[model samples]
Every structure is written in structure tokens, then in C-alpha cells.
Target: MSTVISHRLSLLEDTNDQLKQQLESLFEIGERNEQRFVWLKELVLELLITENTNQLDRTLYSKLSELENIDDVLLFIFVTKPKVKLKHIRDTSLSEVPSRLVSLSKTICEVCRANEYRSIFNVSIDSSGSFALIPYQFKDIQGVLAIGSSEPARFAGRVDTLFLDFLGEVVARVVSRIS
Candidate 1:
């Protein structure tokens, strides 16, 4: 009877160990997802509170640069009425942006207009960088927040749109006040 009880105790210990390992694995995954969501939330709130336009541009670039695999950030405002134009807002890198990026931004803006949804545009430029274009709208004014990285897979299937959508709503409110 003592031997039987000892055997049962050993089995229970093994089961407990397995359960602990499974719980730890789940915790790790949950922590990663939470980090991703938190960064975007902090970024949007920071942008909303920023009062100066120039400072806002700098702040946006700076915040995005802190993210893993993100090397730079660019901002563009789209004007689409009597004439269509994409105005460059800011860029973290001083290097001249590739023409392809401009065209991609235009395409993203059109898609956003057609779908009336915030879209993520992820592209890889040969030997140059990987880019993620996050399209946002403010009333009639449309904009794209571009994130670039030397790491080709940085934004590939990785961007979370929850905070981007929240940022767009906040932008609309701010623009409405100014207009």
C-alpha cells in the first residue's frame, strides 16, 4: 500500500510539472501580444496630446523609431479635391525616399477611400528597406503614416490596426476643431 501511494504521488507530480510548463508558455504568448497593443496605444495618446504640428511630426517619428525592427517613420498628407497631391510631412531618415514609396502611398490612399477602412500596406524594397504604410483619415483630409525598417520582415503580417484606427478618430476630432 505504501508503494502504491508513492507511485501515485510521483504521477501527480509529473502532471503538475506539465501543467506549469503549459501555463508558462501561455503567459509568454499573452505578454508578447500585450506589448504590441500597448506600444500603439501609447503612440496614439502621445500624438493626440502634442500641440505643435512640427513637434508632433518629430514625436511621431521618434516614437515609431523606438519599436523593434522599425528604422524610420514618414508622414504624408493627401489632398484630393480640385487637384490631388501628396504632401510630405516628415521622415526619420534624411535619405531621399524612393519614388516607389510615393506611388505606394497614393495607392494606399485610394484603397482607404474606396473601402472606407484603415489599411496596412507592407512592402519590401530591394536592398533598401521594408515599409509599412498605415493610412489614416481626418474629415476630408487623408494621410499615411509610413514605417520603414532595414529588416525585411518587420511589418510583414505584424502590424496591429486597433491603435491606428483610434489615432485616425482622434485626428479627425483635432482637425475638426482647427477647421
Candidate 2:
């Protein structure tokens, strides 16, 4: 009886050890996935900034869609300051986007008050509302690129803003270079 009990204990220990090894493998895979995602994000940023000129719009859109898996990318530039009107609205396909465009004071629209402003991936100005004052700085002269979707809550307020801020900086730099 004693020998049998010892064998059972050894078998249990072996199973637990195997599980631990499997967990370690899973953890390593997760880390690698994370690294791949970061690299892909960096690549997208590089493409956004580096690709300039009217001819390269399609190429940039293709590269961005492939890398980020986003539906579309629109680059709107506000040439005028204060109440920055969109000087240019360039889409991935170069088709005219008829949606209403505005830049908010902050991420949130004044009338809508929806925190759905995803500064990184989606920066939309309310079409219905008039050109309201942007509470943020305009001296930077960067137009906000709003990601449009039929789905409203996709870019809801809960998302983190760090990645978006990085993208915003890239836009600012790109605009500076173009002008």
C-alpha cells in the first residue's frame, strides 16, 4: 500500500510539471505576439510620416490598411488657424468624403459630449455642429484625422490615449514637413 501511494504522488507531480511547462510555452508565445504588434505599430507610424505628396496617397493608404487593419485613412489638413477649416480631405482611395468635418477643443465633441473621440485611431469632428472653438492648442497646425465608421461605439472613451497621442505627433511632424 505504501509503495502504491508513493507512485500515485509521483504521477501527480509529473502532471503538474507538464502543465507548468505548457504554461511557460504559452507565456513565451504571448510575449512574442506582443513584440510583433509593437513592431507593426512602429512600421505604420513610419509609413504615415514618411509617405508624403499627393501621388503617394494610395500607397500610404494601402500600407496603412495592411499594417493596422483599419477600414480607411483620411488625412484632413486645417490650413486656417483658430477655427481651422479643412483645407484638404484626402482619403485612401482619393474619393470625396462627404461627411461633416470639424476639430474639437478636446477629444469630446461639445454638443454630442460623447467621449468616443479616439484621438489615435479615430478623430472625428461633429458634422451637424458648427465649427466650434478647439479648446486645445492650434499653433501646432495639425488637422485631426477622424476615423469614420457606421458603428458608433467602436472608439468609445474607455480606450487608452497613448498610442493615439503618438500618431498625433506623427501627423504634426508630417504637416510641418509638407508646409
**Candidate that would win on TM-score:** 1
On the 0 to 100 scale, the lDDT of residue 49 in model 2 is 57
TM per candidate = 0.58, 0.47
lDDT of each: 0.54, 0.47
Q: Per-residue error at 162 for model 2, in Å?
A: 1.2
- Model 1 per-residue lDDT tens digits across residues 1-179: 99999999999999999999999999999998899779877876776676655656666667777888766565655443222122225322212333444444322212122111112223333353455566556566555566666665554455555655565556545433433
Candidate 2 weakest lDDT stretch, 10 residues:
128-137
Report the C-alpha lDDT of model 2 over 55-113, residue by residue, as the tens digit: 23554455445633244355665544332223223322112222234424354312223
Q: How much is the lDDT of residue 97 in candidate 1?
A: 34
Best by lDDT: 1
